[model samples]
Target chain A: MAASSRRDGGAAGRAKAERSAWVLLTPMCLLMAVAFILPVGLFLLYSFYRFRGGRLEETFTLETYWRFMTDELYLITIYDTLQLAVLATLLCLVISYPLAYAMWRMRSPGLQKLIAFIVFAPVLVSVVVRSYGWTVVLADQGPVNFILTRLGLTSGPVSLVYNMTGTVISLAHVFLPFVVFPILASMLRLDPTLREAAEDLGASWWKTFRSITLPLTLPGVVAGAQICFTLSLGSFVTPAILGGGRVLVLPIQIYTATSDINWPVAAVGGLCLLVMAFIAVVAFGRLSQYSEAV
Target chain B: MAARIARAGRLPAWRHLALGIFTVAAVVFILAPLVIVILTSFSAQSYAIFPPEGYSLRWYANLAAQTTFYVAALRSLILALVATAASLVIGTMTAYALVRYRPRGHSALKAIFLSPVVLPKMVLGVAVFMLVIKIGFYGSSWNLVLTHTLICVPFVIAIVAASLANFDWSLQEAALDLGSKPLPTFLKVILPQISVSVFISGLLAFVTSFDQVETTMFLMRPGESTLPIEMFLYLQRWQDPTIAALSSVLIVFAIFLLVMTSLVLGRRKITTLQTSAEPQP
Candidate 1:
């Protein structure tokens, strides 16, 4: 009888706990449903709706997607978006790996902390401000151009800003801290003894790094790359400010379409970005798993 | 062992020199724009010219004269504070429930909660804009506050849950056994222990909300822009050094935040990156 009562008490406690859990979760669920899920669903629905003469018709159709697939304009926009993300992510990785490796290999704690702090400092500032700063820094007669001219690398100032080059450079700068921290985290979590063992085995530093450290930290690289790609894919501000109307990516298209009240076009363009971001996330997830397995 | 290897100079001296040079170059690349902005703010020229022919505080004076930025800065500040507070409260409850109760489908539920972090903010912005338009809640400040909260709550939940994962349940149990209620038990026994995490999360959430441009852009009504939006629109119209001055002030604010975060984080500075730095054992 006593054991049975104890079991009954346990069941009652669990029931109460479940009730409390639901209560705590109620606000978040409501917020997501009302704000996030509902809105995204509406976006999906709008993609199927037709926009006739700047008016949104509630009837469902796949006209927008068909147009997106067939139109060279949209096809180019999608291609450019992917290209921008790819280039920015590549730039981030190229810069971050060496920087993270240096941070990991540093013997001085003070210098390491300073470097980490410096890398992270930009993240705190607004992207708009940073993009604007880049424009000035890379402008004609700006420091970069001034230096290049002085060095006789170019007889004339280069048109760096107001172009795809500026957009990619600024995007890479904006996402640099995000990429570096992940790689650095993985390096910090690395097993030191493994490296010592490799060294004792008379393995060269490069060989040990290639055989072990690189593979182990590949997951971090993948994770960082995922962040950079997704952020670049959705980045509207830096590209808007730095792209100088010359680089027309999907986000810019969506913004223009939305402003024009062309809901179908906006929805279609947004869906493309979502699909791209999702693909990158999945691809990176696979790479991270593969790296771990190896 | 790793430090010992580095100290014993297992690598060639040239490699160290190369790494040192690369690090310096990377730092320059990272800081060039920011430093240049501060320098340009003091430029005497009407247009931005590097290594200015002369220096003056004219731009700072011009920035002070622009009242639009002042209003927008105030709006951004209040909005960020409200969003941060709301997210902290809602997120703490959610984290506590998941950690303490171990509810069914806990991992799945957690994933759903964090899904917003991965969802493009631009999409979220457009989606929320459509919803508000549908519900006729367009032009409401609550819309911005709620959307910002949605974006920030994930960071709060992630950090608070991580902190709570390490919390001693014995204290809460003891408090309950002593006839204390759940809310009071949490307040007295749990909150103090996780206060640091809570503060860090709040700080981070504030920054995230304050820096929001992609998400807040569509929701804002005409002439009621946030600070970043105002700056963005202003840049679209002009490329003068007045913006450089405002950006300098913001850069100073960022430095202050960096210092505050470092002081709070102390030795476990890794926690600042804990949102993504969940080191697998």
Candidate 2:
């Protein structure tokens, strides 16, 4: 009889704890519902409304979506946005892989830490500052052009800024830390015994790296690529400063549409960007799963 | 055998040399822009040019005369502080509850909280802008604060929850068994353990909020902007060295933050090492 009563008391205490958990969660849930969920829902709703004569019309029309699908200008912008994102992701992976490999191979922890700090230090600075810095660095008479001219690679200054080339380069730079850290983390997590076994079997260094290290770190590559792609898709500051009016990506299109009071276009353009980001995320998620299974 | 295998796995000296050169080049690429910005800030000329025609402090003087940046900086500092404090409190509570009890659909709840990280800041800006206009809360600082808190809470929850998951619950139980109340037990025991995560998250939250431009742009009243927004607009109008001067100042501030973070992390590492070395009860 005593044991049964004590069991009942334990169940009561657990019930109380559960109740308190709900109470703790209520504020966060309420805040998210009010500030996040409602706003996003409203934004999505606006995408269906019509924009005519320089104003928004509250009619339930698919005109914006239809136009977005059919318009050549919008199609070109989407193409450019995707091209930029893909190129940036590829570039980030290319640059970060070697760097991550080097960091992983470092014998000294102190040197590794210092190198990691150097790699991550840029993240603390504002994107605007970084973008502005790139504009000067890649300008016609800037240091890069100066070097190229001096090296006789080109007789005159080359136009690196105010174009897709500059945008991609700057975006890649902005996302390098994000790419490097994940790859480095996965490299650290790798089992050394596997590599040793591969070597003991008379595999060359290159062979072991190719068959063992590369395949195991594929998840990190996918993860980093996903981040770079998604971030590049919505990147505004770098492209805005570096593109100098030539790079008409979707985020810029949305900003312009909003500034022009074309709310419907803005809303539709934003949704397109969101859709692209979502697709990249989902594709990379599957890739990572496959890589991990390998 | 292991030593032989390791030796065999090591790369040739030439390969290491090549990689070392590549690493140096990568670091240069990563740091070139920042280095140029600082160099440009010291340039006397109006245009950004290589080798900076001549050096002067005139741009710094120009930055000093611009009162707008000062006001914006102050506003950003306060806003970030308030947002960080609020998010830390609310986020810690939610993280504690989620980590301890793990109520039904906990993963879903966590996902909902962290979904903002994936949402484009531009979209969030416009969405909240529309909401504020519709609700007649336009030009309100409170709206900005609340939105910032919403944006920041996800980070805090992610960090704090991770720390809380690894917490030893037996200490709390022991305190409870000694007749201590739950609130005091949490304040005295649970908090001290997770405090480092809290501090790191708070710093991250502050930096994120302080550097925000996309979200803060749509919300701020005309003529009143955050430092980043101010600098962004300034850059749009002029590509002069004054902005570079301002950026240099901000870079110095970032360095300060970096030092602080390293100190905190270093101290925590030492403390953990010491604790692990001590004999357990």
State which candidate has the highest TM-score. Answer: 1
> lDDT tens string, model 2, A144-258?
9999998999988999999999999999998898788778878888999999788778898899999999999998788778878887898888888898898989988988887
Task: State each model's C-alpha RMSD to the native.
Answer: 3.0, 4.7
Pairs that collide, model 1: none
lDDT of 1 at A275: 90
Error of 1 at A221 (Å): 0.8
Candidate 2 local Cα displacement, residue A197, angstroms: 1.7
**Residue-level lDDT tens digits of model 1 in B235-254:** 99988899999999999999
Q: Name the 10 consecutive residues with the lowest summed lDDT in model 1 chain B.
A: B272-281
In model 1, state the lDDT of residue A29.
95
Candidate 2 segments exceeding 4 Å error: A1-14, B1-10, B267-281
